[model samples]
Target: MGNLDKDILEKIDDWLSSSYDEETRASVQKLIDDQAETELIDSFYKDLEFGTGGLRGIMGVGSNRMNKYTIGKATQGLSNYLIKQFPNQEIKVAVSYDSRNNSQSFGQLVAQVFAANGIKVYLFNELRPTPMLSFAIRHFGCKSGVMLTASHNPKEYNGYKAYWNDGSQLTAPHDKNVIDEVNAIASVKDIRFEGNTQNIIPVGEEIDPIYIEANKALSIHPEAVQAQKDLKIVYSPIHGTGITIVPKMLASWGFENVTVVTEQATPDGNFPTVIYPNPEEEDAMALAKKKGEEIDADLVLATDPDADRVGIAVKNSQGQFQLLNGNQIGSLLIYYVLSAKSDLKQLGNNPYIVKTIVTSNLQADIANHYHVAHYETLTGFKYIGELMTKLGDSAQYLAGGEESYGYLVGDLVRDKDAPNSCAFLAEMTAYFKSKGKTVYEVLLDIYQEFGCYQEKLISLTKKGKAGAEEIQAMMAGLRQNLPTTLGGIEVKEIRDYELSQTTDMKTGRKSEITLPKSDVLQFITVDGDVISARPSGTEPKIKFYCSVKGTLHDKSDYLSLQNTLEEKVDRMMKDIVG
Candidate 1:
């Protein structure tokens, strides 16, 4: 065997000869007997690191992969932490999963492990979305929660997302604390694999209606929905868990002319229609787009596999259906909410909003126009959730979103929710229609009013050990030598999140940024361009976000202005890396 193969085999041998269960041993032995060299190697490469997002990897038999044992170990660690953290309190955890191949099984394993540790477990009877799991954690007043999902990743992948009592993913000391607990586990023998049947409660049917009713009350422009009840909309779930509640959420919202994409409607773990199964990908929304074209629908919407994020399509000025990036959707939602509720007498003047640093600044610009305070957090929605918890009682949060199609309307749930976003996006369509406008027209007007804000994201995937080392080197190089300029504009400010320092180029003054330490670098150009570089904590990739903005004189300049901004983004990318 090759050196790499020998290393993998040694890891597998350790698991086989160690204290693993009979079934796990038998599975590994079967791979050995069948001479499945590639499978064995892939499975034993390394243990899956429990990052802030939780555990995620291809489902298989390995110490590092996503399987019953891995899930159990993670739950055991989390359980230990919960017991220690809340010694005097009753420890309860909510568990839910998506429509992936082994999602339900993994979720059950988690519940069983938690229950074995004397913690109460509220488990979903069937596959559910991730957002509900976030909501359930807070709704049930649980200490922590777990969701079995990989978000928009392909079928081969599965994951676990851990949440604290605030309904947000762990941050700062908590994230590190959980990781330490998980690593302290020496072997499978450390896990409490035995489960208590009594503590495991099936919670789907009881919770579904409660979630729908709560969401319905969050609508700000119900009058528009009442007026335009027959608003034409096309939706697709891309063969995931969205079908479970999206249509139901819309029906509850009083949308009557909704058309479901039949071929892509069902809940299938394999995701037969698209290779990526991410709504952000055009190919994944093919059926939805086709249906929109055939019916001449007003708008099209699609959700990722786990239903945490959503993508949209609207009729552009040329009468052609075009996909709206995350920034566009985020901006439109904020605009609709602010403009509609500005006249609401009951609404308070202390209304606040949120978006990630990577999200388009158009949101901040819009909020400024309405005199609302918009906060910027780290890339993850969990940070947005953290802000909500920190500012509880002190400030009223209106909404928050990121550039990856994830959004949260109201504080009902502490995570990015597609069901809520779907309902609101449809309502926004109706609200615009009531003013003799389409959703597309509202977008154009927003651009005209707030300057045409353009943003682009580029991700570079570097796989395996060598890739990891290369990415580290790239980050180190950037930190050591800051770029002087980008897109022909002087770099005025540099924020290194890892160091929590922001340096002004003109005065050479450094100030502390009050946020958790993260490995991110952002540069603000002299001409109002914002460029941020970040490496994914969960995936083996690095992402660069370029944002540029300019005033639009009229509707005729929209396309040309868009193209000019695209060119500026290209030049910025080359300057930063080349």
Candidate 2:
């Protein structure tokens, strides 16, 4: 391209002369001959980074894009690391993909790389969700695994998520060490393209039954499900991998009346039904909501592309459909699990649940009422898995969730699983229905027992290189000028997770925080409001989490208290941004 950086030109030349496929070379040459300056700069300006999860980028024919070369390099690097980590043992890895375009080819490419490197590979015969990949790794006793899907992202993007033997994403030293090995890859020629087909074993039929049975074992009230087997439920997979297992899981859990949104039931990479293939958006769930109304269903559930997160809709007190945010869902799930166990006298010794620091504190109050231990980790699910691994044999993990619709019920799979969550959610609906109460009534009852807690998340996205720099600058500005008061209330404490210290702003006394270092800051006000600021690890955006609470003495006061909390959150956000 004309006026391109010299180094970028050199990289382009290298790719042209390298051992890449003919199609890739033709695309690069066309861009150069056409003098596509903007396209060239965006494609070749920098290399795509393998973050804590693994590789994710827009697919194209450049170092910064997700293509055959980048996928091969990541797989080779992971092969090398696994070989070193498990010396003297036969290293094995599992591979799976989603319904996205080219995902099957990319997944086969990964399996070939691992097999070429003399590593045993267990590849799925067809597309599966990310959670099943995690379960397969632990079930087969593989040393590592890789999943090829961009969870809830747009159609143009794809990603690779690496997992360890414990079935969790990389954490701490392992994550950084994998990055070093990937960066050391010098050329496309270094990747092994030819493979021993015998080393690649297809796995699906053997694992699906076990996985489904394991989830069915998590149900606490099978009797209630049997009694209320006719509870009308509507579901939509949003044209993702959930269509493969979610319906099957529901059937096995003794639910009789289940309706699938036929239009959105098929798995398609283009996601033809919605603008964004995410359950968090109301527009994405519009079709399912309409289906629920026509059928007079009691609940509506929607899952994203990879089926890792789930969102639900239920009738409110006024007999109108209302969407429950992630915080509300998490609260209801934890309350159901804990209270059921307590009622059955199944609360064992040292029982615990986990949540992220950005999640609602209502979880902690629920745990206190049940006399169970509650642990808070950083924002990622890997951190929750890490804590679970660390507390091995000392505590039992009941369930855990984040505020972004990701959750897990048992310890069999370390990652968040929608199939498992859906099964339990259906059971939860049946249990309350058996008692002649709607889910909305159960939620109000929970709030009345424990104070009403409302939370909102606002994300500001910054796009390319300049946008990244601007996000960092915004964080720096907040750290440099700490607000003394927010929402007309005095600031009581400041917790700087980056420094691993909590400071009493009124007295200037600091206390050590016993958690891993992260670039997050939290401001706690005298009125019991919490404001947290942190950047997204997977996307080019920064997020602000605001939480407020009020007394809900009666069902009539619900609307008034909700309005007051919303106003308080608005004021706090304004103060922080100003």
The candidate that achieves the highest lDDT relative to the unseen native structure: 2
The candidate maximizing TM-score is 2
The local distance difference test score of each candidate is 0.88, 0.90
* lDDT of candidate 2 over 1-578, digit per residue (tens): 45578988888888798588889999999988888887787678788888888988878888888999999999888888888888898998999999888899999999999999999999999998889998999899998999999888888889999998888898878888988889899988899988999999998667777999988987899999999888899999999999999988998998889999998999999999887788888998899999999998999999998999999999998988889999888888899999999999887779999999999999999999999999999998989988888898788899899999998987888899989888888889999998898988999999999999988888888876667799999999999999999988889999999999999998999999989899899999987889999988877789999999998999889988999889989898989865
* Candidate 2 similarity to native, TM-score: 0.97
Which residue segments of model 1 deviate by more than 4 Å?
A: 5-10, 26-42
| Clashing residue pairs found in predicted model 2 | none
Runs of candidate 2 exceeding 4 Å displacement: 1-3
**lDDT digits (tens) for residues 1-578 of candidate 1:** 34346668778887797577688889999988887766776677777888887898878789778888788888888998989999988898899999888888888889989999999999999888889998899899998999999888778889999999988988877888898899899888889988889988789677888999999999998988999889999999888889999999999899999999999888888999888888778899788999999999988999988899999998988899999999999999998888877877534657899999889999999999988899999899999998999999788888879999999888898899999999999999998888999888888899999899889888887865667788898889999989988878899999999999999999999999998889999999998899999998767788889999988899889999999999999999888766
Q: Cα deviation of 44 in candidate 2 (Å)? A: 2.1
TM-score, candidate number 1? 0.96
Model 2 lDDT on a 0 to 1 scale = 0.90
